[model samples]
Target: MDSAPIVVHPPTGSGGRRVTVRGEILGLAHSDADVVEFLRRAGLPDAEGLLDDSAWVKWRGGRAHHYEAA
Candidate 1:
């Protein structure tokens, strides 16, 4: 099976980097809105609804960044 690309957006003042995971990480952003922006930029379908148990991201950077439900 194929997986999603991993995109990492640098942190602004949130302390943690924003990440969008389709299969891996499609892109990064500061917030879900930004993440959607990334999706718009990529010209890809919004997979925000696909975020669930299938996506397991363990950040070694301590606490997780702010993310929104798809």
Candidate 2:
């Protein structure tokens, strides 16, 4: 598995994705803003910008910015 600092897990049945930072579960995010907020709270700089940065975040089971399950 990729060892990125942030990982946005696959969306759940309710379309919420689990956001984790350094293996720490931040929360379940339903939107990009929620993920950004989680990162902000975790003290990560430029949280929103990191969304598209593969080196910073690893998006699993979905494309970037996609909250709904495939």
Q: What TM-score would each prediction reach against the true structure?
A: 0.40, 0.90
Error of 2 at 33 (Å): 0.3
Model 2 lDDT tens row, 1-70: 5679899999988788999988889999989999999999999768999998899999999777888854
Instruction: Output the TM-score of candidate 2.
Output: 0.90
As for candidate 2, its clashing pairs are none
RMSD of 1: 6.6
lDDT of 1 by residue, 1-70 (tens): 2243434344545344556544445555555566556665656465454333234333323233454222
Clashing pairs in 1: 5-25, 6-25, 48-70
Model 1 segments more than 4 A misplaced:
1-4, 8-28, 53-70
